[model samples]
Target: MSTRLQSTNIPSIHVVIPGIESLKTSLESISHDTKFEHEKDMMFFRQRGKILIDAMFDYHPIHLMALFLNPRTRKMKQCTNSQRQSCLEYIKQEMIMFDAFDSDTQS
Candidate 1:
């Protein structure tokens, strides 16, 4: 007789929120998982850093606005909400651009 694994037993998908601690942990995990002599992974890491730096500069204004209107401040919820929306829109545009670049490379 064959047995089946239940979907509930499987791990659910999770979206990691971008934060300094989370980013550090993620980089450490990636480094640990990469085996020795993995030049490709090293190169990929460098490329990823470049992309991140580029995105940082591209989104600097949005990020500055978010920081300036941080939720931790008293009664800044509205500013925080606007900043969050701007961030989401910026990320969406970046994703679309990345997808287009990927398609062009694949072709």
Candidate 2:
């Protein structure tokens, strides 16, 4: 995932949102099982997952916007309905602002 994220040709924002989502899903699956073979391994994954999930919260809106703008990722199926709606609202707001600016300049 990190290697793919670092690729020069790919848009990093496009990869980041989905990549983190995939990772979060995997982590949730791992944590779902009650039994753990190794306590240390469980602890390590829990801490790392917590950190990653928390970090994601801080940047989720920006990542969602990037995903929405990308042709391939525009559907953003991985995101929740509320999140998708939020992104749409933000884009609409930006478009309104741009239109206002354009009209003012024309005048």
Candidate 3:
């Protein structure tokens, strides 16, 4: 997944959102009850999941805007209308700022 993200030709954001989803799936798989596992180990993994998710969001909120634009993720049943709108609004404001900077540079 990291390799795909580093590729110059690929849609990097597409790989990113799903990569997290895959992580969540993997976390579930790893933390599930098994005959060989102890209860304390399961508790530790559960705690890790929260920390991981918090860190992911703390990295940057805007980089995640790319996820809202893509149709595949936009129309997902899991994606709410409000989430899309909020991210879109912030992204639009950012684009406007970039355009203003570009105009200043050109002039």
Runs in model 2 lying further than 4 Å from the true structure: 31-36, 39-44
Tens-place lDDT per residue, model 3, 1-107, is: 77877899867765565676566666656534556657677768866995787476532345457676677665533334765666778888999999999999999
Global Cα lDDT for candidate 2: 0.80
Ten consecutive residues with minimal summed lDDT in candidate 1? 12-21
**Model 2 agreement with the true structure over 11-97: per-residue lDDT tens digits:** 688778788778777765555565767866877877798687867565457788998898988999888898899988988988999
- Number of clashes in model 1? 0
Candidate 3 displacement at residue 20 in angstroms: 2.1
Best by lDDT: 2
Q: Give lDDT per model, in order.
A: 0.48, 0.80, 0.66
> Cα deviation of 69 in candidate 1 (Å)?
17
Q: Which stretches of candidate 1 lie over 4 Å from their true place?
A: 1-79
Q: Which ten residues in a row have the lowest lDDT in candidate 2?
A: 27-36
C-alpha lDDT of residue 21 in model 3 = 58
The superposed Cα distance between candidate 1 and the true structure at residue 68, in angstroms, equals 14
